[model samples]
Target: MKPTITITYCPKCGWLLRSSYMATELLTTFADELNGVLLKPAETAGEFCISIDGEPLVDRKAAGGFPEITALKRLVRDRVAPDKSLGHSDRVHAKPDSGKDEK
Candidate 1:
């Protein structure tokens, strides 16, 4: 069975828009793999978390901040479609190290 992704965000903290945006991105990216993305309004203040099938994938409090969209997509892709490629999103941002002489 396909897995469901849930984004729980604190409504009081004005995180609903953020959560909804994430849900849209996940749904679009994982249309073939995910059953759906659920936007859950968190009861706890300042709470924001993403999970797959009730298993926590990331917690804002623990991570100290919200994850970038690219990072979040990579995390979800890893679990839902391990063999899938993320194209530009998967590209490393840092320049590659060149062992050869640069002179």
Candidate 2:
């Protein structure tokens, strides 16, 4: 079964918009890989967490802040579609070492 992503955010903290935006990005990027994205209103104050199948993937308080959209997409993609390419959302790696003497 495809994984479902849950974005649990504190409505009291006005995180609904943030959570919804993340949901949108995840849905767009992993349309085929995900079952669906759930936007949940957190009961606890200042709570913001992303979960997959009830397993916590990220916690805003623990992480010190929210993750950027690209980071969040990468996290979801890694779990739902390990081999999937995220195109511009992907990280840029350092150039490969070239076996040539420095001039």
Candidate 3:
């Protein structure tokens, strides 16, 4: 399953925004509030970026809506947690060091 919510931070201003929502609960709630416009599930992890005009509804300091945020947090956590059995290595290979003459 895809994430219900995706967020991004601005490198310059440190502002955060809602990037996407794919989870059924959040999207369905949002759609219902919008009078029945449904958001389809992604075929292969598509993006759902959006801009916030004002302050973020949720942030590092505190969660805004306790219930909704908690649900979404649980969903995101489940989606991002690495599977230990997968034995995935996160290391990146470094380029070979070049002699000064090669510069």
Candidate 4:
């Protein structure tokens, strides 16, 4: 199975500042973008600061400011699906139908 990873984000600015890519394939696909922002793998296990266009996007010390992160997680979760044939084992199963849950 593909490695399970966590992605953290700011809840205010709608910026996607941090993500974890445990799978080599996923990391390779996102390497360019991660490198563009200087996003590297976490070393210790604490929040890290992130910036874009010289503007502060994430303040790991502060409380609010990560709406961007939340939105990004939602977007990714809603958009990407794993390919089992490609040796990708991680799967986000579709939510089962429930009459009251239908929108």
Candidate 5:
């Protein structure tokens, strides 16, 4: 069974659209893997977090900003669709390996 994905954002902070957009992205990407994606309004000021089955996955307060979409998708995919490929999302944007000689 797929886990429920929940994204809570500050409605008063005018982040409703952001939250909705994430929900849609997750739904579209994990349509067959997720039970559903929920967009919730945060009661506390400056609160934005994503959880899976009630487990905190992303917390803006702790991480100091919104999460990147690719990172979020990876988290969700791990729990809900382990075998599913995230295509471009799987690409690592990490800094170049120090061993690689610069041009």
Candidate 6:
């Protein structure tokens, strides 16, 4: 069974747009893997979280910050489509060790 993704955002914190954006992005990105994406208004103030089938994926309070878009996608992709590629998101972001090459 495909997993249902849920984003709970704090209205007081003005995170509704953020939640909506994630829902849209996830829907488009994981159309083949996800069952549905739900945007829920959080009861607690300043609370924003993402869960898949009730399993916490992004716990803002616990993490002390929101998850980066790539990290969040990685988490979901790992659960839903482990074999799927996330294009640029899946690619490692790095630069060569310039000083080491210079001797």
Candidate 6 yields a Cα-based lDDT of: 0.91
Best by lDDT: 1
List where candidate 2 sits over 4 angstroms from the true fold.
93-103
lDDT of 4 at 63: 39
For model 3, what is the error of residue 85's alpha carbon versus the real structure, in angstroms, after optimal superposition? 41
lDDT of 1 by residue, 1-103 (tens): 9999889999999998889888988888889999999888888899999999999999999999999999999999999999999889999888787888877
User: Judged by lDDT against the true structure, how good is candidate 5?
Assistant: 0.89
Whole-model lDDT values for every prediction: 0.92, 0.90, 0.33, 0.38, 0.89, 0.91
Best by TM-score: 6
Tell me the spans in candidate 6 whose CA falls farther than 4 Å from its real position. 96-98, 101-103
Ten-residue stretch with the least lDDT total in model 3: 82-91
TM-score of 1: 0.90
Q: Candidate 5, after superposition: displacement of residue 41 in Å?
A: 0.9
lDDT of 6 by residue, 29-59 (tens): 9998999999999889999999999998899
* Model 1 lDDT-worst window of ten: 94-103
When sorted by TM-score, best at the front, the candidate numbers are 6, 1, 2, 5, 4, 3
lDDT of 1 at 31: 91
Worst 10 residues of 4 by lDDT: 81-90
Error of 6 at 68 (Å): 1.6
TM-score of each: 0.90, 0.87, 0.22, 0.26, 0.87, 0.91
Model 4 lDDT per residue over 3-101, tens place: 223333333433233343222333454333332323344444455454433344445557353334434333333333322122223335689777585
Per lDDT, what order, best first? 1, 6, 2, 5, 4, 3
Which structure is stronger by lDDT: 3 or 4? Answer: 4
Candidate 1: misplaced stretches above 4 Å? 96-103
